[model samples]
Structures are given as structure tokens and as C-alpha cells.
Target: MLTPYNLPQDMCMKSHFIFLTLICPGPKDPGKKIDIYLQPLIEEMEELWAIGTPTYDVSTDQMFVMKVAIIWTISDFHAYDMLSGWSTHDLMGCPICMEKSGANWLTFSGKLSYFDCHRKFLPPKH
Candidate 1:
């Protein structure tokens, strides 16, 4: 149910929106030296990737749209810890967030998934 906010201020039962994903590991801290040092290299690669494969500019909807923000290493144990303890309670029903729809839960694992509602936009499900 990982339903992100609707795109273009049109997140109803209809209308499709772009999804933004930061697949890279969440930064440890903005000012961390190790991160700052390795960041540029990763960012460079990401930019090249975006240019090399511009799915966002593609004519077809099913084209690859992933744009990696960066890449960095993380301790396996810490990564596991973060994922295992991750919870969406903090994000759900927050009025400040665009996804907030009163009692709506927009998580990918939530009862009402964006995929479940995908038919409202895009071509009919195959």
C-alpha cells in the first residue's frame, strides 16, 4: 500500500502521477565526511545514467523510469536493523503530507494499495 502522494495535485480515483523513489541508502547525516566524499562520484554516475537512459522522456508509459539519486555502501547489519524496524505510523494521516486523506493508509502494504487503484489511470490492466 505504499501509495505516494498524487502527482500534479490530482490524486483522486482518477488521474495518474509520477512517482519519485530514492532507492539508495538513506544518508547517515548531511555533514558526515565519508558520505560527502563519496557522494559526488555516485551523483556523477546517476546523472550519466539519467542521460544514458532517459525513461522520463520516453514516449511509452511502460519504459524504465528509475532515476537513482546516488549509491553508497552500508553495513549489512544496520541496513537490516533499519528495514526491520521501519514503520509507516509516522507518515499515515499526517495533515502536513499531501498523501494524507483523513483515514487513508497509502502504504504499499496497506489495505488499499496504489496498485490496487491503478486502473483509475493508465491503460486497462492486462
Candidate 2:
């Protein structure tokens, strides 16, 4: 299980705490896909969804009802690589706008970065 750790004492805790809740599991090592490994968990989640929530009521016929709305809050990389079946480093990284990004070299780190430059109110129609 991935967890957020305490940062330096001098650093502000507000924004850091916000980042803590956004943590998720993904490809730990290079050249390995996590989809197969996550299958069991996904199956379990499906089972749970099938079971639904058990509620007590005299008039109710069934104990479980299918009233679940699964919200998968994940990082952009995971959204691209795992959920959307797209390569993060490719042209279709952003699921919303589907805008292709170019090599954006950072002056400080001297690293190539490709960030989605487009903005949209809603995701594009499939």
C-alpha cells in the first residue's frame, strides 16, 4: 500500500497534505505493466460493486442494491498509460483534449517534459 510520508519540518504542511491524498499505485520499475498485477484488485472491486451496500429496512426486498458510482482519481500518467490505453510519452497523453505535446526542455533540470497545453470544460466524445 502506498502512503504519504512526513516531509521536512521547515516545509509547509497544507499543500503537502493535499498531495498526500493523490498518491496511487502504478508501474514501479521500468518496462513493466501493472495492469495484470492489478487484475485481482479490480476483480475484487467488481465483486464489491456487485455486492453493493447492505441496508436494513422492513419494506426492502433485497439487502444489497447497486447504487455505486466509482470515481477513479489518478495521476495523468496512470490515466494515460493504464485507464485510457495510451502511452504517456506519446501524442495522446491528455484524455480530455487529446492534444499532443512537444519536447519542453527545462532550463533548471535540463530534462525533457511534455505537458498538456490544451484546456477544455469536458472530455472529448469518444
Candidate 3:
């Protein structure tokens, strides 16, 4: 079911300023392959964003530059993990649990459940 797909996209600021845009192909699954594919784009984005943006202050009639430290992107679960370098499997994979023991599976009403611990390694705050 996992196949490679490509689409052109753009990044916008406050629904006005369009910053970056590109067309790229990637696999449907979130794994090492997708991580490899995203590296170049990530590097390019970092380099461009490091330059910051110039802004004009009307009160002082002066220009200042603002640097952005973070970029938020929306994607599907698999794509999100691929872009963010997160694992989709058990043991430090569950975004809510963050468990590293790899023994978090439990049977609940005749069904296997993840992120549900049977043993008390730690309290469940998630």
C-alpha cells in the first residue's frame, strides 16, 4: 500500500507572505527513506531562514530584521514522523507515552492496545 508520491507546496506567513515552495516526491510510509529525502529541503530551508526578515518601524522610521527560529508544517501522521524524525513503532515511538521499555502492549477487551501499560514503570500522565 505504500507508494511514493510527489506534490508541489508552499509555506505562508499569516496567510499573506509566501516563503518557500517546491515540488518533491516521497514514500507514503514514514521511515528512513523519507528522512533521507527530506534532508536537502530541510537544509535549504534552514539556510534561507537564517537570513531573517527585514521590517520597518513606522514610529522610529527605522528598519529592523527579525529572525525566525521555528517553522511549523502540517502533514499526515506518517509524513509528520518522517519530517520530524520520530519512530512509528513501539518503544519511544508512541508520542503520548514516550516509553523506552518496549513492553507497553496490553490486552483490553480482547483487543491489543498500545500506549496502555499493564506494569507500573511510570504513571500515565498522557
Off by over 4 Å in 3: 1-23, 26-31, 35-41, 48-53, 71-76, 100-112, 115-126
How does each model score on lDDT? Answer: 0.42, 0.51, 0.54
> What value does the lDDT take at residue 46 in candidate 3?
74
In candidate 1, what are the lDDT values of residues 8-41, reduced to their tens digit?
A: 3456323243323234455653222344454666
| Candidate 3 lDDT for residue 80 | 63
Could you tell me which residue pairs clash in candidate 3? Answer: none
Off by over 4 Å in 1: 1-31, 53-74, 78-126
Q: Which numbered prediction scores highest in TM-score against the true structure?
A: 3
Task: List ranges where model 2 is wrong by over 4 Å.
Answer: 1-27, 30-32, 53-68, 99-126
Query: All candidates: CA RMSD in angstroms?
Result: 16.4, 11.6, 9.5
Instruction: Judging by lDDT, tell me the better candidate of 1 and 3.
Output: 3
TM-score of each: 0.21, 0.42, 0.45
Clashes of each: 7, 0, 0
Q: Arrange candidates, best TM-score first.
A: 3, 2, 1
Candidate 3, residues 1-126: lDDT per residue as tens digits?
A: 111121124432234444444445654553556655567766754765788568686778999875444435666756667666777554566575576444445556553344335454656663
lDDT of 2 at 101: 49
